[model samples]
Target: MRVLLTGGAGYIGSHTAVNLISDGNKVLLYDNLSNSDASVINGIAAITGVKPTLIKGDVLDEIGLVNAIEKFKPDAVIHFAGLKSVKESSLKPLEYYSTNVGGIVTLLRAMLKTGVNNVVFSSSATVYDSRQKMPVDENGIVGNAANPYGETKIICEKILADIWRRYSLNVTILRYFNPIGAHPSAMIGENPVYPNNLAPYITEVALGKREYLGVFGNDYPTVDGTGVRDYIHVCDLAEGHSLALKNMDGLKVYNLGTGKGSSVLEVLRAFCNVEERDIPYRIMPRREGDVAELVACCDKAKKELGFAPVYNLTDMARSCLAYARKNFSGKIK
Candidate 1:
């Protein structure tokens, strides 16, 4: 299978590309290199021993997308491009809507023009209403997004469902929970500029890039006061994409996660234990649009797609530390 990935040079996309390539699939990466580095292509090659063809293009560029699709002739496309910061999304709502929403519209139009139909969308667990019961499933109510970033994902999922109904497109929407950790080889992992997520912040403190970690919202109704999320290893999340590709029949939704929640302080302790040192931290107030808990009821995915997460929190922490100590030196672009 020839697969095309938007933002494929980014953290999750790169890991997914490695998994797909290892499974004997050809991959072509289409990315603008906005938030990701070009060196990720090298890392993928180092891991998989196959250098994927990369088109330095944007998802909103319809002509560029069509040209790449025609040239590469991919059997399917995995859309992984867009702005993905919750706090930044609240500050810049228009940009989030334009890029996240508009990019999918353009890609579908290009696919319609070129007769390429299958696509797997990268949605988020934030689409679920936070007030709902714990361990949300595919049948859980959606469209209760807390931030503009999640709102854009909800809109994109709706667009895909509509297209599937009218055009019979094969689409699979994977609502991912909190994805942390790095590849076992430490070649490719998350290295976000500005560090929006907790894993990268924890890694920075371990690497001494920052002074200390910030434990936000120690007053939430969680085991600890901090927020709880289903943190899945990136490798497992990548494998979920590979599984989704095989079962993209009609419009389907699946939550990709470990089916268990971990508090923020619990994750910090895991990292500290892995790094063998205490990382300083201070309690901070919760940011706007933050939720108390977001865990996944992944029984559907596990039963249907054979998606089983083998890594525990300790494994996630160890891989993250390995990636930070190996890849991040002075400054990451």
Candidate 2:
């Protein structure tokens, strides 16, 4: 299969590219490199022993997207391009909406023009309502997004569903939980310019680049009074994308997670144990749009797509530290 991945140089996209290439598939990466490094293409090539083609483009660029699709003639497209920071979304709502929401719109138009009907989207568990119970499923309440980032996902999902209904496009939306951990090779990992997620922040502190990890809101109704999330390994999440590509029938939504929740303090302890160093932390007040707990009920994905996450918190901690020690010594750029 020839697959086209938007934002293919980013963390999750690069991991998925390696998985696709290793599975005997061709991949063409389409990215603008706004928040990602071009060197990730080299890392993917080293891991897979195949250099996937990288098309320097943006998802919102209609002409560019159409040209890439026409040239590559992909069997399917895995859309991953977007602004993904929940906290930053609150500060830059326009940028989040224009890039996240508008990018999907432009991509759909280009796909329609190019007669491409298959797509696997990289959605988020944040689309689920915060008031819902633990372990959210595909049927869980949606549209009560806490931030603009989540709202864009909700909008994109709706648009994809409508497209499937109208044009019979094969759409697979994978709602990912908190994705942590680098590849076992430590070649390609999550390296953001401004660390937004908890795992990256923890890795930064472990590398002595940051003074202390900031425990956002140690007052949530949880085990350690901090936010709890289902942290899935990036490799496992990438495998889910491969599985989704195989099961793209009409329209499907799957939550990609480990089906387990871990508290902030618990994750910190896991990292400290793995690194064999005391990582200091400061508990700060809860920020807006933050949720207490967000877990996934992944029984649907397991039964349907054979999606099984095999990494534990310890593996996540160890791999993240390994990637940090290797990459944090110098600037990622």
Candidate 3:
């Protein structure tokens, strides 16, 4: 099948392109190289042996999207382009909403004109309200986002839902847990603008980018007084996209996680074990809107999409360390 991947040159999108091409599907990647570099396309081509059709364009541009859809005529589309930084969203909520919310509308309009219906969206677990219990399922009540970034995601979901109400748009919304780890080949991984995520921060400490790590809070009432989260490998997350396309029959929501939650200190210890060096750290006060534990109930994904994470915590730590050490200069790890 021919597939169009928006933001396909970004971190997870690049990895997903590799998997899709490996599975013998034709892919055309549409990206603006805003947060992602164009060289990522070369990296993916090197690994997959088949470079996807590259279109330099913005999803918010109706003319550009129409041209891409007309040229590629993809059987399905996986939308991954948007402003993803939570803190940035707080500062520039309008920009986040414009890019995320407006981009979806533009794509949907273009798709309607071109008659391309299948879609796979990269939603987040942040869509779950703060009142959610420990393990969040697809049935958990949706609420207003704690941050602007999450709010944009919720807005996009609503847009997609509204489109589906009138027509049969086969869509699958995959709410990802915390994704970490580099590809085993060490060619591609996450490249955060500010590096706020836990894995990148840990990697920075190991690489001596900073003198010591700072814990957000240690009195969260978790197992070790730190926050707990479900960390899934990036490669496995990419694999889930392929399965999602197979199961995109209706408006289905699946949690892409391991169904196991690990604490902050536990991840630090795991990294220490992988790097063979003790990590120095200092605990700090909790930040605003920080939750104690965020885990996913992934039984639906496992049963329906046949999704199962093969990499363990040690694997994640090792790959993350390798990427951090190799590309600590802030050049697309």
For each candidate in the order shown, give its overall lDDT on alpha carbons. 0.94, 0.93, 0.87
Judging by lDDT, tell me the better candidate of 1 and 2.
1
Q: Please give each candidate's TM-score.
A: 0.98, 0.98, 0.94
| Candidate 2 accuracy as TM-score | 0.98
Candidate 2 clashing pairs, residues 3+ apart or interchain: none
Task: Show the lowest summed lDDT stretch of 10 residues, model 2.
Answer: 324-333
TM-score of 1: 0.98
Residues 1-333, model 2: lDDT tens digits: 999999999999999999999999999999999889899988998898998889889898999999999999999999999999888999999999999999999999999999998999999999999798888899999988999999999999999999999999999999999999999999999987667788898888888778899888987899989999999999999999999999989999999999899999999999999989799999888887788999999999999999999999999999998988888788432
For model 1, how does the per-residue alpha-carbon lDDT over 1-333 read when each residue is reduced to its tens digit?
Answer: 999999999989999999999999999999998888888889999999999988999999999999999999999999999999998999999999999999999999999999988999999998999999999999998977899999999999999999999999999999999999999999999976557889999888888888989887899999989999999999999999999999988889999999999999999999999888899999998988889999999999999899999999999999999999898776533
lDDT of 2 at 216: 82
Give the per-residue lDDT digits (tens) of candidate 3, residues 65-92.
Answer: 9989998889999999987776667888
